[model samples]
Target: MLEVIGLSSAAQTLYAALVERSPATLAELGHDTATAARLEELGLVTRLPGDPPRYVAVSPELALDVLIQARTQQLTEARHRIAQLAARFHRSAPEQDSANLVEVVMGRQAVSRRFERLQREARRQVRVFDAPPYATGAAGNAVEFELLARGVEYRVLYDRRAVEAPGTLATIIGYLGAGEQARVGEVPVKLVLSDHPMAILPLRHDEHAVESALVVHDSTLLGALSELFEMYWERAAPLHVRRGRLAEATGAAEARRDLLPLLAAGLSDTAIAAHLGWSDRTVRRHVRAMMTRLDAQTRFQAGYQVVMRGWLAEP
Candidate 1:
């Protein structure tokens, strides 16, 4: 390590010693030189034949200038190596931000930040094809609210099969009531995106799958998506269709119908909470209430009774 910074010192000592003695043994060449080992380690001297001892430095005084040249070469090689390492890392950069195109962002936070920036810049409208099953949760909703509050025109398309949670439905209606246009329909894929500046996340079913996000801000691309969303919106149902269900059923009943089977399959409350976007306490309460409703002493018994009653078999 010290060899790199001490190269100049090492070169000077080796050359000075050689200038004094044309040919000398290793001991005589750098008898008491601090950098003797460093010079020999650098191949600046050679051992020669002699009974007592003999060593010859590679070059004499005038040509000993090669030491400085060698030093320059070493510095150049070091800089080139560092530059190559920097270039390699540059190529591995996650998102490529360019003036005229969408940026590809990797990892969760970067993707979310790009989406937030788009929402902040939006003016005329914001159109969405929401794939709730792949939703990024609270952080995403906060950004949605931010855009809606700015009076940006907002449109969302939701998958019909999404198991809507309590406040989630209310939130949607509230957004729609505030002039945001929302629609629900079935889609073959799971994703959430908007026009112009849009973010997308692929559906992931594996436990170890990485979450990826992308944001596109190009105007032409945004316009094309806006048109596609408008066409889909024409055939989509409004949030009002499902708002009634939340009012008619208790939260426990909703949980019983939706989460009982998953719970019985040995999923923990946290996993259920993450999947359904419900609080752990809420999930636990629902489980306890279901146990009482079935007159069962435990969750296992309640699950057994639920299946026995054919509720599990119902659509």
Candidate 2:
């Protein structure tokens, strides 16, 4: 881990040994003078004058702070260079072939990093078609929360399958609570569109992993994607947290009200129960009661009644 801050593997090992047992002779730590000298140069170890000089590990809290600062500055400079290169590329894009508008990013890590960078660079909003053969198991986007805090809007359209995936509905609910505008419907592809002039969609050669992605920069293609999102958004059912007087209500009314969005989103009882942390039996009971109360004979009618009755109001 210390390699990220420019420490060699050997130096990191010597530093760890010194940290565990400090003020020891290099010979005792099984390290040569060169390794100890490297650590000392990095300000991670101190050499004291003695018959056979011993090295003391510097306080990690103090030593690592300087290294971290230097690393941060380096990263900042790299970002500047990347910005310059991107600007140059954009300037030359018009003279290049139309094929240059789509850049293929290969490998899972590369795809994931580009996705994160796209979201991070968004100036106004991000629209997503989130279906997921996820590159990472992480269910939530920490970058999204940061963007939300910065007042960047998020409009995410989740496929029903994505919502039904383990722990996904709960995570979606968390994003909704954080002011994301979310809806549930059929998402044809896994896509992310930022306010920037680019959009990314994962290539579907492998269904189990996001091994590659295409970053599209063509204005016509981007406009089509934006229209596609709107079309889906119009058909998708909005998802929101239960709130206001209904939230403060008690008993079956509150329970059924809480279940409205899940029903509207067409989740099965088991999926809804998992999302709400309720037993399967409890979810079934509520669905039956809610249907009876609405005079609906089927789950579909019951969900329609929920919307007609305006039970899924914004929180």
Candidate 3:
């Protein structure tokens, strides 16, 4: 673990020994002078002037924190440099070779890292085609919230099937509450577009884990993906949070108001029930009441009525 911060194995072992038995002579710690010197340079150990100089291990809470902070700064700088290089490469690669526009990233961790970097580097917006067979769990996407808080616009188009997946509706609702412009529709592919330059799409659609993906740079393919997102976004129904007068109400009224977006998104009754933590029968009752109040005979009609009345307005 200490190697991550540029500590040699010998130095790490020496530091561990000193920590376990502090204020010990170098010989007593079973490490040579060079290892102790290295640890001292890293501020992990201190040497006292005595007949035979003894070393004291610095408290890990303080010493390791300093090392960790330094390492984090170095990594951040490295990432910035890599981003610069990537931008330059993307600008020049197309003229040199058209095939260079799309890079293949292999392995789940690489794909996940690429996806995160793309989002982190976005200056304006992130457009996503969210569907099933995800490379990663939706719950682990804390980065999206961070970006949203930073005023980065997020436009996410959730597939109907993705919305109906177990525990996914609640997650989508959280994103909606966080100022994400969300919609539900038939997504033709799984894609993530950052600004207008870069996009990523999975290479495999099997039931197995995602093993590979294509990272598309500024190219015709990327422009087409951006257009594809806009096309679906226009056709998809916008998902909104329960707000205004309905949000102030309690019981069935508020529940029915909350149900409008889900219904419009074409989510099943079971999906809505799971998200609201209500029984299926109760969900059905509220749906029927809402339909009757709207004077609509079907769920689709009820959804249209709510949108037309502007009942599900954003705060």
Candidate 4:
């Protein structure tokens, strides 16, 4: 938060200490006097004059108001400038298309067409949540290999189920080795994000079937989707499973390793399934299996067994 307001790390640390401790003197605070003075200049701290002078921490409510206003003003100006640049760079569009930010593309074929078009039109990055609900049965996606050849960055996150998805492993492996950064997690709702300030999220939030899709333009919703993808991306481990060779089992050990912490964190069956991109029934099945493995009669006992086995990695 301090960094958002352009405060240095040292300045933030000192300001926090001052706010919490209410240091009567800079010397007592035991921080660089220059940093305190900088904070004072930023209206984060106030120096009260006295025989024994003191530095007072300003109320964050007041200080942050000033910062927020400044940032808002700057963002407004930036929007104006971006609008101007966009006007110059972009061709005039159809009135109907321009009027609507969210365009609903119906049917699987239309969605696939949009995917290809978005990829080609994108200037820099392409983000995709690859999972079920295939529009085409060609064993690959709408994105072309020419994209990477031309230096377009691809950040694709696959559902754990999708990584083991039939006829898709070799394609995923090619993408992973060909400079496309990939990771796997349980992600529902298939969508594509292009560099052109828009995203394609499913009309249905809970399912992967692409009967329809919402093309989200530059809006708060688009920003939130980007953030959501980032949150999933951060939690998702990079795919390290060896290429080729379909194992007899889907490999529960690794999957269990990933599932334990979320279980420990007390996420519900449905919530865990949503994050891991598995079904609720599948999650319950796994829990039952885990309970049986540990010879536990209850979820509580299974949890205890997981902890006892150092599954939580407690030191």
Candidate 5:
């Protein structure tokens, strides 16, 4: 909460303590005049108007507003200054400087920070190739939805396993419902690109810690990455998240329903099994059952039945 309000660690510690143990004098709290004075100035701690005045914590609603406004104003001013400096810097930047085109960022925190910053600063679009192993959580998903709400087009390409993991299909369904375009297929690398100019990719494909990341600016490499994204997007099958009974259902029925589009798109059963996180035998079994249900003799007939039955349409 203090982080959200932009308070220093020391201030947060003192404020939390006061809120927990209020109506106590500074001395009783084992604090001297200096610390108390600072907290008072920040409107985190208040004093009762009586003999030997006691310090108390201000209401969180009022104090948080004060802190948030202060930080917001400071951010507004800083952004103004940064805009001016950026204009000057970009004006002097060398367009042909190959040495400065790519920057390496080290450590997990720094990589995560840069990734989130790129998403937050995206102007028109954000393209992401999501794969495992991933340490990020629902917060990242929430932020993406928020950005989508603000008219930033999100094109997300997820690895087959990433979508097949338990509980992920529903999340993808929600994303599709919110106007996000998604595809599921095998991808070589995890990537994040904002508006086609800036990109963040792992330093090594197999490393799990995100120990290093490469930030790519506008360059030939960026173009290659963009083309690579387009290539996968083209070959990838469209993802339609089913709702109602399909949404409430899981297991074989759910997986079979998801498999229809790939079948319609002419993907082999092996590829469909890989995407659906099932074995070849399981896929074949489901396909045979589906063919029987439709009284069809071939996969093509079953796929035609899918379209005719409206199984591929949005709910």
Candidate 6:
């Protein structure tokens, strides 16, 4: 069976019309007039000067040549357009990657991109969830420094498990010393989550699992995740003075309100440490320091006194 292919039904009809009336105008040809008219416009037919637009198909030899030329021009234009797009896509790759995704990433370089996203998005407030004590590498640390220099507020929730990593402990302490919000607690999972452009890291410490990351930019998703972080922050113990205060609560204190609600939530020290990339020991140390500073006997008491005196809001 010799199967004819390529030309659409309308195109075949138009071509048949042209063959029947070799020198007929569009009005005279009348076969698939719409298709024929389009072909005529593409210069497959010759339109002579007359009262109305009159069309006649060029010789077969000439018409095929014109069609081939038209197709070649179309392909050439498409290639050029693709090249331009590729150049622009590479230029905007970093910023654009931050706006999408929710999954795990393997390899150091792939992880680097997530860090870049956090640095770029750490604007007003940066809340972290389930991270390592030394979750961020040197490049990541530098980015955090840049964020601090830019006056971007930050909050971290760390898992107690990360305390095992001494390097992570030092990193968290350094960030605290630099005046960023950091806390330690027990988390259900080990991951790093952000607000606007969020990223997550696994807590297992296994370098092979690529299923340990997540990134999201959708407003609803991020908001819900932020609420989760807040919920955890409430129950988690305070490792340092939050919102700039003396870590005490007496009467008519002048500090701004701290994240007391977060501390009130059920997040444990280990979970808290994981979320913010801090160690459990660091979390405990900060809490102990705060307790001593506030003259409170227990965690609840310390939190209560601070809230009562409103010292959490102090500068």
lDDT of each: 0.57, 0.83, 0.83, 0.73, 0.76, 0.58
lDDT of 6 by residue, 64-143 (tens): 66666677788899999999999999999867665554555655556666756766775566666544433444433666
lDDT of 4 at 110: 92
Off by over 4 Å in 1: 1-100, 138-140, 163-167, 188-210, 219-223, 241-246, 249-315
Better of 1 and 3 by lDDT: 3
Candidate with maximal lDDT: 2
Q: Write the residue-wise lDDT of candidate 2 on 1-315 in tens digits.
A: 888998999999999999999899988989899888888888999999997998999999999999999999999999999999999998988778587878999898898899899988888999999887777558468888889989999999999889888778668767878889988877878889988867999766458448989998857888998889889887777787654121222566577667887788888988887777788998898889888989999998998887787777734
Candidate 2 colliding pairs, count: 0
Ranking by lDDT: 2, 3, 5, 4, 6, 1
Give the clash count for model 4.
Answer: 2
Model 4 quality (TM-score): 0.47
Show the colliding residue pairs in model 3. none
> In terms of lDDT, which candidate is stronger, 4 or 5?
5
Off by over 4 Å in 5: 1-96, 138-140, 244-246, 249-257, 262-285, 290-315
Clashing pairs in 5: none
lDDT tens per residue, model 4, 118-193: 8888899998888876665565753657798889999988875665544464576577666677766657568788
**Ranking by TM-score, best first?**
2, 3, 5, 4, 6, 1
Which candidate number has the best TM-score? 2
Better of 2 and 3 by lDDT: 2
Clashes of each: 3, 0, 0, 2, 0, 50
lDDT per residue, candidate 3, 1-315, as tens digits?
Answer: 779998999998888888899899987866799888889999999999997999999999999999999999999999999999999998997688777799999998898899899999999899999887766765557889999999999999999988877777667767878888888877988899998579999887766436799999987888898899999887677777654121222565467667777777777888877766777897798888888999999988887887788765633
TM-scores of the candidates are: 0.40, 0.64, 0.63, 0.47, 0.55, 0.43
